[model samples]
Target: MWNHNYEDELIKCHRFAVGLAKEIDYKNQRLLEMEHKYNETMATVCRLKEEVKSKDTRFLEMKQKYNESSATVKRLMNETDLLHSEMRKTQSINRKPDEALKCKKKELDQQAKELEESKAHNDLERRSFLNDIEKLKEELQAQEEKTDAIENLNSVLLVKEHMINQELQEARKESIESLQNMLTGRSKLGIKRMGEVDWKPFGDICSQKFPGEDWAKISAELCSEWQEKLKNPHWHPFKKVMENDEPQEQIDEGDEDLKELKTKWGEDVYEAVTKALLEMNEVNASGSYAVPEIWNLMEDRRASMKEIIQYIIKQLRAHMRKRKRC
Candidate 1:
């Protein structure tokens, strides 16, 4: 009876394992389907971008053709007007018979009617061309909006993919731990195996790479590597490092210089000097000012200061030149 019971429990465990394996297989197939769909979406976005580019090129070509056609029509109309003027002069000078004159008048009336029809047709074509241009503009705007939406969707997908990867890694870790526990649980039966793994000796590897380099040089190189790693403008670590690196003495000296300039030159000269100094820097123009109070005051008075200083400097420089020449 005991042997039968043991066999029954083993069978039950086997059935559970089989069920888990089938579930895993189904999950893998679903993952593959999702991956295929992601690939298709990416391909579609690429094709759409190419199509939009082609459409823009075609639109520009059409616009140029329309402009050229309009110019040709205008030239033809001018030539027709000149010919009409010449015909009128000839009619007056020739003094043909009254019936011939009436016939000529009838022919001129038909020609005028044809010309008016041609002008109306040309006007219709111009309106149609303008409508086509407006349609293209609307399409371009819609395409741009779609591209932006796709970009946003891609960003969201990237975040989801990262989350999925992290979860998968955690699952793999849990599986490994479970396997290790099962092996250890078999130690009482003398069925356990043991081995050791050690971390690579990073210090030894470094020593081997730089066999004769001193510790000081290695330390300095490491510090430089760390410095490069920390140099992100948006990161707090680099900003803090930069602020600390500025010597107190140098900062005090700079403050003293600014104070003295302000005290001697007053607010106007101080503002002008600050503007000149800031304007001298290309980066300052491109980037936001670090010192807002100083920069704002200078920027507010910049145009006026520019004109006044320029005039004053020109006079002073000319006076100095004359004195030197004399």
Candidate 2:
């Protein structure tokens, strides 16, 4: 009996060892995945660092240019002041020569001639100086504007990069949260501890809706369908504006429509979509006037249908091109 008890204990120990070994193997797999993710993150960080370095170099170059431009403007300003003083001296000399009671008026005519020539030369110099000043001021303003633009770009780039990283993190967090919720909800339902209002069924239904296929292909197909839907005339604005055809009223109305859409769709997607639409409309309008009715149709169709509106203009362009060829 003692030997049998000892054998049973040995069997239990062997089973425990196998289970522990399996757990260790599972942990090792997870470790490998974590290491792979870490390496990928490091590579991404390196790329970002290089991008930031390039941007910084560009910023420094712009700064240097701006300084040089500012210096040139200051020099021009000084030259302008010197020219003004010379003009004042010439004016005073003109007065003295005209009023001079000495040496009689014998050489007055010659002096007057020389004075006039000097005046012409001085006037030319003054005009040239003023032009130079204006040019330098314009250059300085342009440089300042460029610098500001570059700074804004730098700030925007940094913000966009940070937002991208934040979005990636949020996506991962949301995915994990969703997975956890799904697991918990499933477990609750399985154990009969879920309420009538529990959403497990809905979650499961949604999960079933996604086919186990390439999501990229699925997205492409969906976008193509949307594009087709947009191209359909059912959504087209009758008498839509073209780039060369937009009247002031129509432009204002379009701007209003854009504002409304932005209010409705939030900013991002609306901004992207509206800007594209505006470009298309501007191209179609091309500084030409369209009827108010046409403008109204555009406003009406834009909300309910965008692709159809674009398609109509596309057709018009094609028709015009054909006519021109004929």
Predicted structure with the largest lDDT when compared to the true one: 1
lDDT of 1 by residue, 217-278 (tens): 66445434323322323322111123466722112224454467467435543444343333
RMSD from true fold, candidate 2: 36.8
> Of the candidates shown, which would achieve the greatest TM-score relative to the real structure?
1
The C-alpha lDDT values of all candidates are 0.52, 0.50
After superposition, the stretches of candidate 2 with alpha carbons farther than 4 Å from their true spots are 1-103, 177-326
Q: What tens digits encode model 2's per-residue C-alpha lDDT throughout 190-238?
A: 1111101223322333344455756445444533433333333343222
- lDDT for model 2: 0.50
Q: Give the Å shift of residue 212 in candidate 2.
A: 57
lDDT score, residue 220, model 1? 49
Model 2 TM-score on a 0 to 1 scale = 0.23
Each prediction's RMSD over C-alphas, in Å, is 35.5, 36.8
Candidate 1, pairs of clashing residues = none
